[model samples]
Target: MSVEFSVFLIAVAFIGLVVSIIILLRKAMATLDEANKALAEAREAVRDLGSEAGSVLGHANDIAAQVKDKIRAIDAIVNSAQDVGQILHTVTDTARKAVAVLNHTPQAAQPEYVPTNKITIRKTSIDALAKETDRI
Candidate 1:
C-alpha cells in the first residue's frame, strides 16, 4: 500500500474511536444524572417518613399521658375504697356492741304504766292557752 493511503486509514480509525468514546461518555453522563435524580427522590421519601414517625411518636406520648392519668384515678378510687372499708368496720363494731348490751340487759316481767296529765277547758280557755303558748 501507499504511505498516504495508510496514513489516511489510520486517521479515519482514530476519528471513529474518538466518536465512539464521546458517545459512551454521553451515555454514562445521562445514567449518572438519572441516578442523582433517584437519590434525591429517595432522600425526600425518607424525610416524609421521618415526619410521619415524629407524628406517631407524639401520639404515643399523648396515649402514655392518658394512661398515667387513668392510673392516678384508679389510685384515688382505691383510697376511697379503703376509707369506705374503715367506715364499715366502725359501723359493724358499734352494731356488735349494741347487740351485746341488748342481750345482757334484763327485761321487766310487768310493764310500768305512766299517767299523762289531761287538761279539759272551754274554747275560750283554749284560745287563751294558745295565745300564751304563741307568746312564749
Candidate 2:
C-alpha cells in the first residue's frame, strides 16, 4: 500500500478510538453525577434521622425524669406508712406487756358481800332484748 494511504487509515483508527473513549468518559461522568445526587439525598436523610432521634431521646429523658419523681414520691409515702406501722406495733407491744404484768401481779383479797351499787347488767337473747332493752 502507499504510505500516505496507510497513514490516513491509522489516523482514522486513532480518531475513532479517541471518539469511543470520549463517549465512554461521558457515560462515566453521568454515572458519577447520579451517584453524587444519590449520596446527597442519603446525607439529607441521615441528617433528618439524627434530628428525629435527638427529639426521641429528649422525650425519653423527660419521661424517665417524671418516673423518677413519681418513684421518689411513692418512696416517701412508703416510708411514712412504715413509720406509722412501726409506731402502732410499738404501742400494741407496750399494751400487751402491761396487761401481762398486771395479770401476773398478786391481787388483794375480795370483801364479802358488799352491795353498794344500784344498777345491774344482765345478758339475754334477742327474744328477751325485745322486752328488756337495758339487759346486755
Candidate 3:
C-alpha cells in the first residue's frame, strides 16, 4: 500500500474512535443529568417534610401549653375543694360535740316511735320471687 493511503486509513480509524468516545460521553452526561434531577426531587421532598414537621411541632407546643394551663387551673380547683372539705369536716365535728354535750343526762322515759311506712311480708310470694331471681 502507498504511505499516504495507510496514513489516511489510520486517521479515519482515529476519527471513528474519537466519535465513539464522544457518544459515550454524551450518554454519561445524560445519566448524570437524570441523577441530578432525582437528587433535586429528593431535596425538595426533604424540605417539604421538614416544614410539615415544624408546623406539627408548633401545634403540639401550643396544645402542650394549653394543657399545662388547664392542669394548673384544675390543680387550683382541687386545692380549693380540699379546703372546703376540710372546713365542712371541722364544722360537722363541732356540731357533733355540741350535740353530745347537750345529751349528757340520760332520760328515764323513752321517746315515742314514728313509723314512716308499713311493710307486709307474704310467705307464699317470697319463695316464688327468690326462684325467679335465681332463674334470671
Candidate 4:
C-alpha cells in the first residue's frame, strides 16, 4: 500500500509542473507579439523620416541652383555697366577735345577804314541824261 500511494503522489506533482510550464510559455508568446508590433511601428516612423529628409534635400538643391543663376546674372549686369562707363568716358573725352578746338580757332578780322565820296551832275538833253543815269 505504501508503494502505491508514493507513485500516485509523484504522478500528481508531474502534472502540476507541466501545467505551469505551459502557462509561462503562453505569457512569453504574448510579450513577443507586443514587441513585434512595436518594432513594426518604429520601422514605419523611420521610413517616414527618411522620406521627409529626402524632400528637404531636394528643395535645398533647387534653391542652390536658383542662387547660382542669380549670381551669373548679376555678373553679366556688372560687366555691361563697366562697358557703358567706358563708352561714356570716351564720349566725354571727345566732347572736351571738340570744345578746346572751338575755343582756340581764329575769327575773321573786320576792315579798319572806309572812305566817303560825293559826285557832281550836269544838265543835258533830257532823254540822253536819263539813259546815262540809268546805266550808272
Please provide the root mean square deviation of candidate 3 (C-alpha atoms, Å). 15.2
Best by TM-score: 2
Stretches of model 2 off by over 4 angstroms after superposition: 108-136
Span of ten consecutive residues with least summed lDDT in model 2:
119-128
TM-score to native of every candidate shown: 0.69, 0.73, 0.69, 0.58
How far in Å is the alpha carbon of 81 misplaced in model 1? 1.7
Worst 10 residues of 4 by lDDT: 119-128
- Badly placed stretches (over 4 Å) of model 4 are 89-136
User: What lDDT tens digits, residue by residue, belong to model 1 across residues 1-115?
Assistant: 6999999999999999999999999999999999999999999999999999999999999999999999999999999999999877766565555444434545423423535
Better of 1 and 4 by lDDT: 1
Tens digit per residue, CA lDDT, model 3, 1-136: 6999999999999999999999999999999999999999999999999999999999999999999999999999999999999977766565555444434524414533537585333453455445544543
- Span of 10 residues, lowest total lDDT, candidate 3: 105-114
Q: Is candidate 2 or candidate 4 better by TM-score?
A: 2
lDDT digits (tens) for residues 33-96 of candidate 4: 9999999999999999999999999999999999999999999999999999997776656555
TM-score of model 1 relative to the true fold? Answer: 0.69
Order the candidate numbers by TM-score, best to worst. Answer: 2, 3, 1, 4
